[model samples]
Target: MTPTITDAPDRAEAAALLHAVADPARLAVIRRLADSPACVCDLQEQVPIALSLLSYHLKVLRAADLVTSRRRGRWLDYSLTPDALERLHAALPAPPPRHPGPTAGAGEAATPQPYTAACPPQCADQIQ
Candidate 1:
């Protein structure tokens, strides 16, 4: 089901979440975590960013509640929140439903030739 704005977080929270994932580095982290939980060391290897920068991105994800971390001995393993995907999906508007267009009958041109005159000057090359 398509999620309405009401189904997602408040405007500010939703914007924060969207902004958090908008970064390429953060997106890489999310994609890696989608496969399985991994330590910061592992993420560093995959994302290839400085540890401090990676941590900063992770912190942003945590603040958005899209990722969670668990401490194991001296290492912290990170994973996506259970509702992370749903929450992200809900933050955006759904595309309008598609409607069938009129079809041409046998031997009929799909586009009427007269309509070509309506094409803008920039589209002249494409009209024919």
Candidate 2:
């Protein structure tokens, strides 16, 4: 969906947000977090990366505001931000709105002209 003007982030922040999920590991982390909150240990079980590496990915997710964390005793549990979907909605690089093609069978206007760039018939035979 095209975001409303108020829903869009400024350019630089948007770039950073897009970059956050650009990594495979981090994307996996976010995908899991989307379902529910998870601690680093919980994430490590699912992510193939080492603990240190997973932590690094989590840091990137946090920076993008794609995820949030809470400290419970020794564990840091990560969850998708309350507005994560909204930010995603805002961050989507909207496809340029398509112009309507001529309605199906609307008229001759819907037909494409034949290719005129082909070599002239005489030239075609010369190469043959």
Candidate 3:
């Protein structure tokens, strides 16, 4: 297949997404929102951080489009975006082979490998 062309701006956007979820606090919030939409009160209880901090985390998530905020009466409800995980998944490079697949021999046992991808700073450089 022809190589996929990834421009600098696209890499930067992906890198920003990587940076947004890099924090444990932010990651926790994402997991919570993935299940259902919730207000600050709901998120604050799920995470140990203070309400103010929770708001900050939500801001970061919102910026990355990982979550959406909607005004509901007196509360602000947040929900995970439909394609958030997909976008993040697409940003990383495909995982490398764990152990070389079945050798030249026929009917050789092929080891099973779980999918694993990494998105370090150099990951952008690898973008085709």
Query: Best by lDDT, which number?
Result: 1
TM-score computed on alpha carbons, candidate 2: 0.67
Arrange candidates by lDDT, descending.
Answer: 1, 3, 2
- In terms of TM-score, which candidate is strongest? 1
lDDT per residue (tens digit) for residues 8-97 in model 1: 346666788899999999999999999999999999999998999999999999998999999999999999999898888878777655
Off by over 4 Å in 1: 6-9, 102-128
Global Cα RMSD, each model:
5.9, 7.5, 8.9
Candidate 2 regions with alpha-carbon error over 4 angstroms: 1-9, 96-128
Question: TM-scores of the models, in the given order?
Answer: 0.73, 0.67, 0.70
lDDT of 2: 0.77
Global Cα lDDT for candidate 3: 0.80
Cα RMSD for predicted model 3 = 8.9
Which of the predicted structures, 2 or 3, would earn the higher lDDT when compared with the native?
Answer: 3
User: How much is 32 displaced in model 3, in angstroms?
Assistant: 1.1
Q: Give the Cα error of residue 114 in candidate 2, in Å.
A: 13
